[model samples]
Target: MFRAARPFIFRLDAERAHWLTVHALANAPWAAGWAADPVDDPVTLMGLRFRNRVGLAAGMDKDGIALEGWQRLGFGFAEIGTVTPRAQPGNPKPRIFRDVGSEAIINRLGFNNGGVDACVQRVARHRAKGMLVGINIGRNKDTSPEQAVDDYRYGFEAVYPVADYITINISSPNTPGLRDLQAEAALDGLLGALADTRARLADAKSVHRPVLLKIAPDLDDAGIRSAAAIALKHGIDGFIATNTTIARPPGLSAKVSGEAGGLSGPPLAEKARHVLRTLRAECGTSVPLIGVGGIDSPEAAKARIADGADLLQLYTGLVYHGPGLVSRLARAVSTS
Candidate 1:
């Protein structure tokens, strides 16, 4: 069905087409039946059971309006948001661009989300449905870097009760100075603050939810090591191998290749995989890792597992391959 609709969907603006698909899944009841159940490749990591290894990565459903739709579409888990404490319009128009031939997308969409509070309300409605959901939280654009921890803490406190796990997203290149939080001292401060907050919340709520860090692919070797070390020091639960890349690899459509933003898809596979391998090596088997970026096929999925990823995620791949990739990937990783 996606193959048939590709031409028309591609004709529309990339961001518009994306929201249309998200809205359709949210509003169209019949869209729930669009996929078959993914193979049962249960993964027990960070004390949570994932029905399968395949997850819808954070950027795809920032506000998570289609929780039921994601579950029905066969994603074992869906990481929603890069959500901010307060709602923001995000970057200006033409923020998302696609290179259909290369199956790549460059997005400078920023963290355009409907604030953590509203997102929590939407997620609360479907929190009991049993799908593992991770809410990815971020600091708002207007928030100064010095006070980033406060924004993250607010988002953390807001979604702590509902999120199966929480991902601290400081990797998106589109957000100005956002990735700067990955710096050793800044990361230490942020993680330290959140760690203390989590201890309090866990004791108060009497429930513990895993907290994962999502890092950018642009980090250098030294940077990756520092981030991993800090996270381990704070007892962070897991790591999402990479976010999008600012570096434009060769062969992308020249028209959009130079666009200022983060690039995802096949161009990102190598770098993302490298980061995954590095994290696996640095953190060893103790830290669970979620591999994403340019994973458009079963082979890529298998490769990620071999590279030491405990789970896998998809975003740009779905834009090109459609929902069927979920089940296919789940099956591929089930036995690995």
Candidate 2:
């Protein structure tokens, strides 16, 4: 059904098509039945039991609007948001462009969301559904680099109760100065604040939800080492080794490739895998790593696991291949 409908969906604007798909899943009474149940292959990471290792990445369901839908679609877990403490409209229209030829997407949508309060409420309402949900939190666009930690702190506190885990997203290229949080001093300060806040939250709530740091794919070896060291020093629980890349790959459409945004899909696989491998080497076995970037096939999924990913995530893959890709990858991982 999705295969048949994708052509029509793809005909719409990229962002519009995304919203349409999410809305349909959220509203469809039969959406779950449409997807085959994923193979049962459980893995425990962050002390949480995932039914499988193939997770829906953060950017796909940014507002937690379709949590149950993703689980029903065969994902082991679904990460929602890159949400902010306060709501803000993202970049101007046409912020999302599809590179059909490259089977990729370039998006500068920013972290446009309905704010933490709204997202928290949504999670609270759906937490009983039994799907593992991770909330990816970021600062509002207007928030300055110096004040960024406060926004993340607020986001942590707001979603702590309902979120299965929390992700501190500091790598998005759309927000001005957001990537500055990845710098040594700035990252150290942010993670230190987050660690203190997490400890306090754990003490008060009697629950310790793991916090993962999401970094950009544009980093070099030194940068990767610096970030990994900072994460380890602060006792950060894990790392999502990449977000999206600011650099365009060679031979992409000269027209759409020049757009200003993060590029994702096949072009990101090599760089993302390299970063994951480097992080795995640096962090060793102590910290968990969620590999995400251009995984569109069962072979690519297997490759990510081989490259030292404890788990895997997909956004652009789902955009290109439809939901069936989740079950296929899950089965492949389970049997492997």
Candidate 3:
């Protein structure tokens, strides 16, 4: 059905097509039926039991608009947000561009979201249905980099009660000065404060939720090692390596290739896999890893696992291949 509809959907603006798909899934009575029975491959990581290893990545459902819908779509889990503390308009129009030839997307959407409070309410309404949901949190665009720790802490507190895991997103290229948090000194301080906050939250709530750091794919080898060291030192439960890349791959169309924002899709697979392998090597089996980038097929999904990703996520791949991709990858992982 998605393959048949893609031509028409792809005609619309990339962002518009995305929301249309989300709304359709959210509203469709038959949406759950669209997914095949999920492959039964359970794994315990970060103290949570995931029904399967294939998950829908953060950017696909930013506002938690389709929490139940994702589970029905056969995903083992779904991550929502990159949401800020307060609502913001994000970047101007045409922030999302599709590079059809490359099977990639360039998004400068700038963390546009309806704020943490709105998403919290949404999650509260649907969380009881028993979906394993991860909340990905970020600072507002206007929030200063120096004061970013406060935003992360606030996000952590707001979503702690409901989240299966919390992802601290400091890697998006669209937000100015956001990546600065990845620096050695900056990362240490920010994560230390967050760790302290997590301990307090856990104590008060009597529930210890896993915390994962999402890093950019643009990091060098030394940078990856340094980030892993910081994650270990701060007791981060896991790592999502990585976010989209700022560097455009060779042979991309100049028209969309030059557009400013993070590039995600097939072009990002190699770098993302490399980073995952490096993180796995550095952190060993103790620290879990969720790999996302250019995974669109069963083989790609299996390869990510081989490269040390304990779990996998998809966004652009879903756009190109449709919801069936989730079940296919889940089955592939299970049989492998």
Q: What's the number of clashes in each of the models?
A: 0, 0, 0
Q: Give the range where candidate 3 is weakest over 10 consecutive residues by summed lDDT.
A: 29-38
Query: What range of 10 consecutive residues in model 1 has the weakest lDDT sum?
Result: 29-38
Over 1-336, each residue of candidate 2 has an lDDT whose tens digit, in order, gives 668977888999999999888998889825675766776688888899898999999988888888878878888999999899998889999899999988899999998888999999999999898789999999998887778889999999999999999999999999999998888999999999999999999999999898899999999999999999998888888999789999988957999998999999999999999999999999888689999999999999999999999889999999888888999999887844
Local lDDT at 198 for model 3: 88
> lDDT values of the candidates?
0.92, 0.90, 0.90
Instruction: Give candidate 3 regions above 4 Å deviation.
Output: none
Query: Using lDDT as the measure, which candidate wins?
Result: 1
Candidate 1's residue-wise lDDT over 125-216, tens digit each?
98788889999999999999999999999999999999999999999998899999999999999999999999999999999999999999
Q: Distance (Å) between predicted and true CA of 231, model 1?
A: 0.6
Q: Candidate 3: deviation at residue 281, Å?
A: 0.9
Give candidate 2's whole-model lDDT. 0.90
* TM-score of model 3 (CA atoms): 0.98
Ranked by lDDT, the better of candidates 1 and 3 is 1
Report how far residue 15 has shifted in candidate 2, in Å: 0.8
lDDT for 118 (candidate 2): 96
Question: lDDT, candidate 3, residue 149?
Answer: 91
Q: How accurate is candidate 3 locally (lDDT)?
A: 0.90
Write the residue-wise lDDT of candidate 3 on 89-187 in tens digits: 899988999999989999999988999989999999987898899999999999988889999889989999988999999999999999999999999
